[model samples]
Target: MPFRRRQLLALGALGAFAMQAQAAEPAAFPSKPVTFVVQQSPGSTGDLVARALGDALSRRWGVGVVVENKPGANGMLATSQVARAKPDGYTLLVSGSTPLAFNPHLYPNVPYDLRKDFSYIAPIQDAPFVLLASPRSKLTSYGQFVAAAQARPGELTYGSGGVGNSTHLVMEMVVEASKTTLRHIPFNGVGPAMLSTMTGDTDLMVSVLPSALGQIAGGKVVALAVSGKARVAQLPNVPSFEELGIQGPPTPGSLVLIGPARMPQPLVERINADVRVVQQEEALQAKFREFQTQIFSGPPSAGAGRFLREYEEWGAFIKARGIQAN
Candidate 1:
C-alpha cells in the first residue's frame, strides 16, 4: 500500500518534504515508468536479484520496472548513466561490488562518484564466495590446496572476474593472510572463470556461491572452504575460513540498490520501509532458495553508510594490491 498522507504528516516535515519532492519534476514522480540499470549481464546473480525486486516493486506501484543491462567498461557506462539521472527515484542503480565500492580506484578516469551520486535504498543480499578445485585435481582439502600452492608458488592458477574485483581481491586477501602465492587469472566475469576451472584450464576459482553451486552439486568441482566467518547453510559441510583458524575478515557480497543522491529523505524512507516489508515476505524468502542468497534488508542510513565506508576501503585495497585490468 502507498504511504498514507496522514502518517507522513505525523512526521510533519516529512509530509511537506514528500510533497516538495514531486515539485519541479517532469510529468510526475514515476508518472511514466521506472528503469533499473544493472551493471551486470542478463541472468547474472545481481541481475536476477534486481529483476525479482523490480518485479515485486512494479507490481506494487502499478508502474513498469524495466531492467536495462549495460555490462561494459567495468560498469562505468551504467554508473555514469544513473549518476546523471534525475533524483526523482525513477532511475535506480542496481550496483554490485565492482561498480559502487571498487571501481573508482581501479579505473583511471571514472565517470561517476559513488558517494556523491547515489542515495542507497538497501543492501539486496550478502552471499560469500566459494573456492572450488577440479575433481581430477590432487588438491582435495584446504590443507592440500595450501600445500600445493606453497610447493609451486604462483603455479596453481586461480580465476576471478578481473583484478580489483571482489573475486580477485578476496582471494588475494586469502593468499596474503596465509602467506601463500598463486597465479591470478582474470576473466571478464564469473561465468567464464568458473568454466575455466571446470574445463581444467584453471586450477582454482574464487566465485560467488550462485555461479558455482550447480557444478559443486554435480561433483565437478571440489568444494573447498568458503571466505566467510561462518559456513553457508546451503553448503553445510563446507567449512569457512574462520572455522579453519584462518585470519581474514568476514567477506560478503556487496549488492545494493540506490537512486541518484539528494533524493528526498521521505522518498528514501518510503522505499526503505517497502524493502523492509519485502524482506519479510515468504515468496521472496522462497526465491532466495534458487540463488542461495541471504537478504540483508535495512534502512537506507545503515546501507548508505556501508556503501560510503566500503567505497573508500576498496579504493585503498585496489591500489595497495597492485590489481589492474587487462
Candidate 2:
C-alpha cells in the first residue's frame, strides 16, 4: 500500500477501537469498588439507607460498594464533595430532600446548585413527617390544632430541628395552607425539638414518622396530623394533612441517590435499573417498613424534577416566612 493509503487505514482502525471502548463503558462499570458518600453520620436515617443500598448493589454487581459518612453542614459538605467528584458513576451521593431540595434556598452561600452539580439517579425511600401536639396544649385533632393556631396567632409556638430544616418548612407549609400564624422555635436537632414539644416548651412540632413512632406509641405527645396524602398504618387514627383539607409539601422525606453531573446516560440508566431491583427485594422491603418509609419509584430525571419543584415551592415559603439557617 502507498503512504497515504496506510495512513488512512491506521486512522480508521483507531476510530473503530475508540468506538468499541465507548460502547463497552457502561457494561464495564464498577469493575472496581464504588463509593456512596452519605450526607448524614453513622446510624442516621440517611446512613442506614445508604449502607443497605450499598449492600444490595454490591450483591447485584459482584463488586464492593462502600458507604462513606460525611455528616455536617446540613449535608452540604458531603454534597459538595460529590459535586466536585469526576462524573464517572463510581462516586455518588446519598441524601435527603433537605440537602438537594431545601438547602440552596435556605442557605445564601450554598456551594453547589442541585440542577447544575448532580445527576439524580433514583429515590430510595420516602419518610413522611407528622405534626404532633403536647398534651398540655389540649390539641387532639388537626382541625383543633388549626383552630387554636388561628385563635392564638403568633402566640402558639412550634419547634423544629433547625431554622431551615424540612421539619421547619413543613410546619411553614401548614401555617400558610391553614392561614394561621405560629411562632417558630429552632433547636439544634430533632431530638431536642421533639423533647421541647413533649415538655410543652413548644405547643407543637414536626417529626419524621420513624423517629416519632416511639414517642407516639408511648403517648409522649399527641399525634394531631401526619404529612403525605394518606394516613400511615402506625398512626391509624390520625388523619393525614390532605384528609384534613391541607396539602403538605411533595416528597419532603424522600431519600435519594445521585451522582456527579454530566454522567453518561447509559451508566445512569444502569444504576437506576439496578436500584429498582434492589428496592423490590423482600429483605429491603422489611427494612423499609421497619424504618417507616416506602419506596419512591421513577426514572433518574424524576428526582431532578422533584428537586426543582420542591426548591421553588419551599423557596417561596422560606422567604415569605423569613426562615434562615443557624
Candidate 3:
C-alpha cells in the first residue's frame, strides 16, 4: 500500500481504539459516598432538606450519603466551605435562599462569589413560610393581624430567626406592603422565634411551614397567611399573601443542591436527573407534602440561572430595605 494509504489506516485505527477506551470507562459519579454539607443546624429547614435528599439519593445510588451541618455566619461559613471543596461531585452544599442568594447582599463580606465559585446542581424544594399570630393575641385572620399592627404601630412585636435571615427579610416585605409598623424581636433561630410567638413573648412570627406545621395544627399559633403564590393543601383554610391582596416576598425560601465550581456538566445533569426521579417517588412526594414544601424540579441549567435571578431579586430587596447581617 502507498504511504498515504497506510497513514490514513493508522489514524482510523487510533480513532477506533480511543472510542473503545472511552466506552470501557465506567461512570465515576457516586462511586463512593456523597457528603451534603448543610448550612443550618439539624432540624432546620435546610438540614431537613439535605437529610431527606441524602437518604433518597443513598438508596438510589447504593452508597452512603452523609449530611454534615456547619451552621453559622448566616450560612456563609458552610457555603464558602463547600465552594472551596473539591469539584469531584462528592461534596455538595444543601442550602436555602438565605445563604445561596440573599447572604451576598445581607452580609458585608460574603466569602464566595455565587456565580463564579459554585455549580447549582438541583433545586430541592420551595419552602414558603407561614405567618403565624400567637393564639393569645386573638388575631385569627390576616386582615385582623394587619389591623392590630397598624393600630399599634411598633407596639406589636414580631419574632424572626435573626436580623438578616429570610424570616426577617420576608417580614420586612410584609411590613412594607402592609404599611404597618411591627417591632422586630430577633431570636437565635426560627425555632426559638416560633416558640416565642407561641408563648406570646412575640405577637407574630414568620416560619418555614415544616417547622410550624405541628403548632399550627394544634392551635398553638394562628396561621394567618402563607408566603407562596397559592395556599398549600395542608393549610387549605389559610390564605396566601397574594390571595389577601398583599405583595409577598419575591420568592419563597428555596433549598438547592449545589457543588463547588467546575463540576462536569454531565455530572451535574446526572445528579439533577437522579434528584428529580427521587422527588417523583410517591412516598417521598407524600413526605414533602407533610413538610409543606413544594418540589422545585428542573434541569441543572435552569437551576443555575434561577439562582442568579434570585440573587439579584433578593439582593435588591435587601439593599433597598437596609437589611443587615446582625
lDDT of each prediction vs. the true structure?
A: 0.78, 0.84, 0.84
Off by over 4 Å in 3: 1-26
Could you give the candidate ranking by TM-score, starting with the highest? 3, 2, 1
lDDT of 3 by residue, 142-175 (tens): 8998898888889999999888888888888888
What is the per-residue lDDT of model 2 for residues 197-282, given as tens digits with 9 covering 90 to 100?
99999999888888888788888899988887898888889988888877645748877889998998888998999999988898
User: Which of candidates 2 and 3 is the stronger one according to lDDT?
Assistant: 2
List TM-score per model, in order: 0.88, 0.90, 0.91
Better of 1 and 2 by lDDT: 2
Give the worst 10-residue stretch by lDDT in candidate 3.
20-29
Candidate 1 lDDT by residue in tens digits, 5-95 = 7666678987677767565333344566789999889988889888888777776677888999998877778888888998888888888
Candidate achieving higher TM-score, 1 or 2: 2
Q: What is the lDDT of residue 81 in candidate 3?
A: 86
TM-score of 1: 0.88
